[model samples]
Every structure is written in C-alpha cells, then in structure tokens.
Target: MNAPALKSKCLPTYLVIDTSSSMKSHESLLNDTVDHVFDVVGNSPRVAEFAHVSIITFNTDAHVVLELSDIETVENLPTITCQGTTNYGKMFQLVKQRIDADISGLTHDGRRAVLRPAVFILTDGEPMDKDWATQFNALTDASWRRRPHIISYGFGTANATVLGKIATKAAYLATDVDKEKEAIVSMLTSLLNTLVASASAQEFRIPDDVPGYTRVPIEFVD
Candidate 1:
C-alpha cells in the first residue's frame, strides 16, 4: 500500500490577541480560551492536514508568540502578558511583514502556495497609536491578492469605530466583556469553529449570529 500523499494546498491562520493592561483582569479567561482553541485544531485531522497556525500578541509593541507552524506541532500556546497601551499600527505592521516572509518561506519549501490567509483579532480597548488607519489600509490592500480576511472581535470596552476599520469582512462586539461569561464562552466556541472551517476553505463567510456577539458592518475605504 502507498503512503498517503500530503495535501498540496495550505491555509494560514493568524490569531492576534491584545495584551494591554486593560486585559489583565481577563488573563485566565484568555488563557483557557486560547488553550481550547489550540487543542481543538491540533486534534482535528482535517485542520492539521491543511492549516498552519500562528499567534501574535500586541500592546505597546507587537510580537509573535508562536510562529507559523502546522497545527499538529503546536505544543504550548503562550500566555499573553497585559501591559502598555494599545497601538494598532504596531500590530498591523508586524502582521504584514510576517505574512510576506511566511508566504515566501512556504513557497521556497516546495509547498503549494497558501490561499488568502485568515486573521482573527481580539481586543478589549481602543488603539492609542496615531494614524493607525494608514497601516491597516496597507495591510488589507486588495491589490496584494494574498491579503488576509480579517475578523475583528471586541470585548465590551473595545472601541467599535477602530475595530470596524481593522476588520476586512466582519467585526463582532460582545455585549458585556468579562461579565457575561456565557456569552464570552459562546463567542469563543464559534470562533474555534470558524477557524477550523477556514482551514479547508477557499472563501470567507461569517456566521449570521455568533451566540454572544453582534455583527457590526463596516464600510471599507476605496
């Protein structure tokens, strides 16, 4: 019998989380949610066969907590540290550069090119950076062809205006940040499902309603 051939096409998924001081109170919650997400994806044969996952955390500065790797290879998801002010520009720039480098690496390694990447961002506060929009726009430039589909999520205290600009396809806001425990759980569960589905998908689709979130439609600047 022949060994199974590896899947040719791959999907890259980025999870960008906020680690500003405001999020300190929810450290445990964030940790557990991320743990569950990684566990679910790592164990799913479908996701493991088609997806590469990465984790990024940002506050005053942005850094990659986990570099892009096959989901199956993810052992420990880093715990985010809460400090400094939120700077959206710093995060966008980091992602843009990393994605460019990552895609190049994948192609060089003789792997089929990745489809448009998917980015899931979670933040609970407003951005403090001036001119953050410029960086965000550059990152989502449609001309790039490989531009990612960004799905932004805001906790209760998050600024809807900023998130609307950050998200490419959808922006979801929680009713009450940490107080609504059930809602938060539901939202995280829905996010996990979305991430897993995107691994084998070529297009993006948003759920009508994510148990604990309300869709906030955004108008992209031309």
Candidate 2:
C-alpha cells in the first residue's frame, strides 16, 4: 500500500504598491528595494519554502507585476513605472480577484494547506476614486472566508484616515518628509523581517515596530 502524502502549510503574501505619477521621483528606489527583497527571500531556504509572494501595482489601473510563486523560481523582476492617477477601486477589485484565484490554486488536490493571506500596501497619495470604499468592503467582506489581513503604509500626501480605514491588521505613516528614502527602506525591510519571522514561527507574524513611521489607529464603528 502507498503512504498518504502530507500537506505543506503555505502563506500567500502580496505586496501591493501604488505607482501613481506622484511616486515617479522614487521609482528607481522602489524598484531596487523590491528586487532586493526578492533576492533576500529567494536565498533564504526556509522563508522561500513557506511564503509564496506576489507583487501587485495600482495607478490608473491595477497590474499583476508578479504572480504568486516560489521566490527562487522568479527569473526576472519587472520594472515598476509610475504614471497615471491613484485608483483605489481598481486596486481593490484586482486584489480580491487575485486572492480568490491564488487560494484556489494553492489548495488544489490538497497538496498544500493555505493560511489567511497577508497584503502589504504602500501608497504615496490619497485615492482619486470616491467609491473606493465600496470595492474595499467587498474585498474585505466579513462573510468571506478568504479575506486577507491588510497592512497599509502611507507616505508623502497619503491620507491617514484612509490608511486607517484600509488596514484590517495595522496602518503606518511616515514621520519625516525629508527622509523619504529612509522611510521606504524601513517599510520594505520590515516586510522582509515579517516574512522571515513568520516562517520560523510557522504562522503569520506582524512587526512589533517600524522605524521612521508611526502606527495609525484604526477606527471601528458599532
């Protein structure tokens, strides 16, 4: 008789970046930091084995820069171009669609057991679409079993109130406008650290603190 296969635990992690025109100034830095992050994870055998990563970018439209995959398998990292307006509705809709497809694919044939996904969003400005919240609500519907835990990072002119509303797990805002480079580095570093720790702990782990940023309080209505 053949032995039964053991399912490996998987974490679907998404990095959702805002590539609006305002972020053009930091485009090169953003691309470099993202590529560095991938390189670090790809080299770490344990983290790479546990966390499957995807990259999503949003501007006038949302794009899947990288599909969820083993970090080591990604050959070429795409260059992120900053243009167009920040459309939150499009971003949220695309994230929801990708999550549905990703979760299903991960669990196919019971080869892997997926945990709740984690979404890390970095934005430099307020959303241009007025009805973005509607799309957000649909993506984060309480009834939906696959809804991800969202963590938002805001810098430049990003609205704190909006970041608070968008984050299901936590929100952060950069403290110094003069140190934009440092802030970006800190955010990406924290993300990499979170994945490394989570893989070691065998579960999802949020960073306790992020330098150059302040945690935003999330508002809840009864």
Candidate 1 runs further than 4 Å off: 1-6, 176-184, 200-203
The sequence of per-residue lDDT tens digits that candidate 2 reaches over residues 1-222 is 975675678899999999999999999999999999999999998999889999999999999999998898999999999999999999999999999999998887354569899999999899998999899999889889999999999998888999999999989999854677788899999999999999999899999789888899875321
Top-scoring candidate (lDDT): 2
The 10 consecutive residues of candidate 2 with the worst lDDT sum are 213-222
Worst 10 residues of 1 by lDDT: 176-185
| Local accuracy by lDDT, each model | 0.78, 0.91
**Model 2 spans > 4 angstroms off:** 1-4, 109-111, 220-222
TM-score of each: 0.89, 0.95
Best by TM-score: 2
Q: In model 2, what lDDT does residue 195 have?
A: 97
